[model samples]
Target chain A: MKMISENVWEIPREGKMRVPARIFASDILMEKIKADKSLLQVKNVAALPGIQKFSLAMPDAHQGYGFSIGGVAAFDMDEGIISPGGVGYDINCSVRLLRTDMMEDDISSKRKQLLEELSKEVPAGVGRSSKMRLSREELDEVLSTGAKWAVKKGYGTVKDLKHIEEGGSMQGRPDKVSDLAKKRGMPQIGTLGAGNHFLEMQKVDKIFMPEVAERFGITKPGQVMVMIHCGSRGLGHQVASDYIRAMENKFGISHLPDRELINAPISSELGQDYYHAMSAAANFGFANKQMITHWVRQCFDKVFGSNENMDTVYEVCHNIAKMEQHMIDGEKKKLCVHRKGATRSFGPGKEEVPEDYRDLGQPVIIPGSMGTASYLLVGTKKAEEISFGSTAHGAGRVASRSEALRTVRGEQVKKELKQKGIEVWGHSSKGLAEEAPQFYKDVDEVVRVSDALGIGKMVARVVPLAVLKG
Target chain B: MKFKFFDHTADIKFQAYGSSKEEAFKNAALALTEFIIEEDIKAVQEKTIEVEGMDEKQLLYSWLEQFLILLDTEGFLLSTIEELKIDGNKLKAKVKGDSAENYKLTGDAKAITYHDMEITHDDGWMVQVVIDI
Candidate 1:
């Protein structure tokens, strides 16, 4: 193990570890990891084919399916492997931020109305789908095209696509996705499904870096910001499920150490097919968020009477794998980076970023639970050197939902959030209890570690004013 | 003795009572798997599986999830549970199951969810488990 810094450590390849392991955490975080099996999962990821540099973990790392939740590992295109667990079941489960010209005072009186409208417009809960339904052919196009499908459908503007990561579409063949996945996805596009999915109305409460905030068009304390957290919904879930089962069947009874760690080499047909389907789902997720953004604008218009001038700040997906070139061992090489429960933190001047904000790097939108402080951060060069240009996803869970329900009442949590002046709307009170802010670690602490490690630099802090939960 | 469905989330948690902790865990897994597959436990083909855990509670969790994984992946529904032995964190079990396609369940579970799950000894023995539907 190589200690890159006091907080970061590298686990060099030993035995079956195909690559090394890189961990980003403070001494205190390391203690927490030692108490959990997340570190072991990270080591297992290092064993996957095509992994380069190290299997990296962010500060908010936690045990998950195959790879640790806050993990990032890049594999070579020719030899790397992709696991469904690495991308997670949620597909492009992601976060989108929209900085508005209006201030908190402008919307405070309408918070309740705003939330109600949002809840009404955005379907939530299990088996919930939006009012929009697509034919089988349309669904196929959506699965193949990603956000570009939504733009062509006029669900969102071209400018919205420009601000999104990868131009809101990762180009590749998506015809490989299964028909079953497409069928499962057709009805769920533009819907908000359950389990930690939400849309929150927030205000820029603090600005940590004035220049960065100004460049991103975020200014004036109390300015309202909208954050939406959701994913590719059933389509993404089906894609992951389909591939996982296929992989298991292929490796059946093979004495694989873990069933969830099933994977295939990138060069194989199975691997390429999974990648195409996953990318399609990621694109669908981008389109889903874009559709939600359009509805959010409509909700705002109904409440505030105008959305003609509202703009999208940034839209990004946290759960995904992509092909990118990064400096590895002093030489740039192509790699397929898998980031689950982690966000890309590409430093400034990268062509991937929009020209206007190229110098400021990508805007990393990290959402906290409703009634907590969310943050907007920018990628740093230090992150490229250390974490393969990645950062923590959110305040990782400290307790499971069931554990929270034992002590925290759903009604009580709802009342508490209301008392805090945040309007809340949810499908069920029980769902709220599962997502109680107390069930997670302090998001501020998670962001603080990222800033301290110089992976992501904070730009602004946002506090929720209204929330719509699934 | 009695089954009570807790508040509706993605998973459904129910409480069951037995005379001993071991019995309670066994019954909980049986009930949970039954709830997931919505079928009679008598038709499944008998299969034995072993899972090692760190402690009795962890062992119970793994044991239940092992059956859950089977039910989820292979559509194997439990028909009969013959034995459950726990030695520290290690759990060994023999369960019978055929196919889940023939079994009728109240709901189809996507997978065994981590929403709300617990195994505790109360007056007799009580367990609460939530299955993702």
Candidate 2:
């Protein structure tokens, strides 16, 4: 690995690698990243055929299935491949930030009551079924229509769709998804599944770019906001498993470096089928988050006496692969961009960005660990030039669940949060201990690296007031 | 006591040990069940599942996938294996457990992966896999 810049390191193409690997990290973060096999995974990704430029790892990259948790790579349209590992098993696992009218002074006393209501309204944790059961046909519609299905069913408003990625729906084909995937997904939708997923109420603490923050509906310090972090539940996982088996059957894994990276050519019939199936799973995620948002609104009304005005600021799909047009060899061409544990940081004037905030750039919501401060950032053009318009997703995990369990106790974590004036409601104490803040790298440090690299600009910073974990 | 969990950065990695191949596969399933609910469940209902794969890795993958499907489709959490037989790339298993409503699930095992998977039966049966949690 060679230092390309103050914060950029490069691993030259060697052996079977088709392209070089680039990682964006500061010196302090580099030390932690080198402690794992994520760097090796980055090199493995570069070996994929038709890879564009360089296989990139974000500042928060960590070891995951086949790709690093914060890995990003764009593939050519005709020669590239699409793998379940690249798209992520939890298809379209994403984050949504909502702005509320309530201020710190207004909710300081009633925070506990509000959280209690939210816990009842939103079913969370493992194996918790949704209150509303979907018939086979209805679930299929959700697979195709995404959050729009929720809005049509009176779960949310039409206006909320504007703030979500892909307008809350993609070109999905439910027929492409297997029966097992649908069966597994039917009961899991409209739930916030466990492990690093959370819903937090936060108050804006600082506004670095006053203009951009104002454009994003973030008005003044101490303004309260809601952040929902979750994904498509069992449906996404099953689609990945079923297709991985299919791909392995058709194309053996002997030629590949890693069996988990089993793939199909981009133009193959099975590849397109997997794409549609993956899109359907992505839609399930959008609808799931949409329903949770509706329940959150109702819970606010139940707790506050008067309904609060909560508006969707923006939503970004963290783990997904999309067909996007970008400059390649001085010509605009469409390519498949896979962002696994990364966010799309499209700069100002991109047509893909929502019209409301297009001039100010897309709003990127990066959630930190529990009881830690989250950040709101704006996309940048420099990111498009160097890193394929991507940024880190979160403070990536640095320790295993067993390691965290051995070092920390759930009760001690809760007590520490209470001392910090933050309250938490969790479904399992063991889950809580595993997700302790110390188990993850520092989010503040991550945001600083992104800012320094000019991939994402910090607009505002917010600290949690209350946390709800599954 | 038949299985041990190792430190993996972003997922759960475990190795199950047994005196025979059948025992090792059963122990692997037990590790998955314990991840969700550590408490031993009472056998109130049973399921007979048949799994087919192209190879031993797929055999293991198919076996784990059956239990996951049961958890989501039937809400049946596996407790104990009443009988299991593995022949070539196919396996038949009869397992018993109660409904998910009977217990509190602690973790979500997203999927089984082929990354760093290992299976050996020369000296003694040992199977290693990573669960995408």
Candidate 3:
């Protein structure tokens, strides 16, 4: 590995590598990255067919199944292939923020009640189902229409659409999703599946860029907000499994370095089917968040009289693959950009950005672990040139759940967090133990790397007041 | 414990051992359930599962994936493997477990992955698997 710049490390193209591998990290983070097999995974991704420019990893990079988490790779649409590993098992696993007119003081006295209501209203953990269930036909509508279906069903207001990624919907072919996936998804509409997914109440503590924060409607410190982090649930997992099997069946996995990196040509029939199915699951993810947003509003209303003061700030997907137009070799080309554990940070003036945010750039919500600080940043043109308009999603895990469980008991973690002034509620103590603060990297440092690289600029930061997890 | 967990940075890794292939597979399944929920093995209910695969590795993957699907759809949590038989690429097993809703679950396993996965028969039967959580 060679240092390309101050923070960019390069692994030169060699052997089967179709492109060079680049990792964006500081010297300290680079050492931590090399301590594991993440770099080897990056090299493996570089070897994929039709890869363009470089296969990249963010500062928070960590070893994952096939593609390292925090990985970003773009493949030529015509000659490229779509790999399920590139998008991860949880399709469109994402984060969203909701701003409220209430200040921190308003929520201070009601913390316990608010958390209790949220825990009761939002179904979570293993084998959990939401009170709201859709029929097979209604589930198809959710697959196709995304958040629009929820709004049409009166779950949220029509005005909530503009604050979401892609206006809370994408072009999805519901027919591409299998019956089994549909069945599994029908009962999970508003549920939050387990493993690092959460709903947290927070307070904006600082504003890094007042101008940007003001334009984004995040003015003043001590303001209250809610962050929801989750994904497509069973629907997305089944789609990923189904497509991986289909790809392996058509083109045997003997040639691949890993079975999880299974892929089908983008122009092939199986590839199109996977893309459509993935989009359908992504739609489910959008609708899932939207429906949960309704429940969050209800929770807030129960605690603070009326929730009319609440409004969605923005929603962003961290795990997904999109057919996007990017500049390659001084010419415009369409590519399939896969971000496994990264978020889209499309820069200022992009047509896809919401109108209110077009001048300020898209809002990038980075949720930290319980008892840590989460950040709100904006996309930059520099990111469009360097990291495929993407940035780190979260403070990527540094330790496994079992490692965490061994050192810290769940009840101990809960007590520790309470001592730090952060209330925690969950289904079990073991679940809380797995998400111990030590298990994740310092998100403040992760965002610092992102800002230093100019991929995303920090706008504001919020610390958790209460956390509800599976 | 018939199995022990290995350290992985992001996901869960474990190795199970048994004197026979069927026992190894059964131990592996128990290890998986233990990772998710700490509960007693109550065989008040049972379900017969049949799966087809191209090889032993694929069979292991299919077997685990099927249970994960059941966990998602039917709220079924495996307590034990009452019986197990394998013929070439085909596998038939009778799994016993109570409903997940009645038990206390700690975490959710997303899906069983095939990354660096293998089943070895050195001295005794053993298999290594990584689960995406």
Candidate 4:
């Protein structure tokens, strides 16, 4: 590894690598990254045909199937390739924060009851059906219109769309989505699928940058907020499977470094089909969170006697591919940017960001582990120049699920959190154990690196008060 | 035991062994079933599934992926594999299981992945897969 700057390291372009691989991390984080296969995955991504600048990894980088979880790469629209591995299986797996008028102390006594109500209102766990079972036609509309469709169905208000990425809906062609994908997705809408998907009640713990926090509406400490982390559920998974099979059948690149890196030319019909289908799935993800937002409001109303006037802070997807024009070699070029386990961090004044936040920069929510503090960060202009405007998504895991389970039991974890005045409700003990806070790197360090590298700057921090995990 | 778990940083990893390739695939399916539901379920219901692939590698991939789709769409929790047959691209199997209501599901497996997937014949036959949860 060659040091490019203080917190950036480079894997020099080598055999079959079209470009160098870059990672934004401190020396300490780099040590951990070097110990995993993530660095190799970065090199593999650089090897992909027509990758621009470099295959970049965010501070929270970790080994994933083909692309590292915190991976980001841009491809030339006319000559590059689009691999399903770059987008991940859970299409548009994202985070949304809902700010409430109430404070933490006001809801402290009712935390347990609120958790119970949320658990009942939001369907979770394995093979759980959603409260809203849409017809085939309704599901297609959801695939096309995304959160806008959910809002039309009385799930949320139109004002919420303005704060969401892509204005709550991308350019999705519902016809591109297969019938089987619809079958799996139709019943899972509004449902929080299992494994790390969670709905947590949090309190404003600390304000790192008071000005940015104020601009983003984190006015005071102890202000209550809700963060939802989920995705398109089974529908996204099926779409990935369907496309990977199609790409493999059409382009038999068996000699490639990883079979999972199978891709189609971005200009090909197959690639266009995948782009449309994936956009539809991403819309499903957007609408999925919006529908759940409706139920979350209902849960609050059921617990607090009146609607708490929860407003959308911002919603952003970590897993996605978008067509954007960026400067390359001092010339503007259209590129397909793939960000898996990485968030889009369009800086201040970018037209893609919401108008209200145009001067303040986009709000990038990074959820920590259940027992840790999460951060709200703002994108930076420097990120757009160097990293294609991307940043870390979460505290990447250091310990495996089995290893975490071996060290502690879920009931014990729950007990410890309760002793600390945090209420946790999970469907299974094993699931809770697997998601133990100790399993992940400290989010504080990850954000610091992002700030140091000018990718993202910290705004506010929030700690979990009550957690509902699937 | 026909199957055992391994450590993968982000996903669930496991390997199953059997006397033949078909048996290995069966044991692999059982491993997925056990991962989803912790407790053993009775073989009260039966379903016959058929799939076709271009080769053995795809056959194994399609086999596991098909079962996952069934679990999501039909809620068919597996109790046991009654029979298995494979000839080139085609595969036929009969599996017995109960409805999802009869078992307590412990985990949610999103998909069967090709990441580091392998099938080999060392002593008998062995298959390894990483499931994204």
Decide which is better by DockQ, 2 or 3: 2
DockQ of each: 0.07, 0.87, 0.75, 0.77
- Per residue, candidate 4 scores C-alpha lDDT tens digits across B35-78 of 88879888999999898875676778889987788877787888
For each candidate in the order shown, give its overall lDDT on alpha carbons: 0.78, 0.91, 0.89, 0.90
Q: Between which residue pairs do clashes occur in model 3?
A: none
Tens-digit per-residue lDDT, A12-123, candidate 2: 9998899999999999999988999889999999999889999999999988778888999999989999888998889999999999888888888998998889888898
- TM-scores for chain B, in order? 0.79, 0.97, 0.95, 0.95
Return the TM-scores of chain A for each candidate in numbered order.
Answer: 0.97, 0.99, 0.99, 0.98
Candidate 1 deviant stretches above 4 angstroms: A1-3, A172-174, A253-255, B1-133
Q: Order the candidates by TM-score, highest first — what do you get?
A: 2, 4, 3, 1
Q: Quick one: best lDDT, which candidate?
A: 2
Q: B66-89, model 3: which lDDT tens digit per residue? A: 888877788888888989998888
| Docking quality band of candidate 4, CAPRI definitions | medium
The best candidate in terms of DockQ: 2
Arrange candidates, best DockQ first.
Answer: 2, 4, 3, 1
Residue-pair clashes per prediction, in order, are: 9, 0, 0, 0
What's the TM-score of every candidate structure? Answer: 0.81, 0.99, 0.98, 0.99
Model 4 ranges with Cα > 4 A deviation: none
User: Residue A437, candidate 2: how far off, in angstroms?
Assistant: 0.4
Expressed as tens digits, the lDDT of each residue in A1-470 for candidate 1 is 66787678888888789878888887777776666678888998888777887899998888776777898999888878888878887878899998788988999998888888888888776545568878877777776677888889987788888889888887535586777667667767898777688899999999999889987878879989889999887667767767876776575525545556778888888888889889888888988888888899999888998876567778767889888789988998888888999999989988887777898899998888767999999998898888888999988777655577687877899899998988888776667887898877778878888999999999999999988987
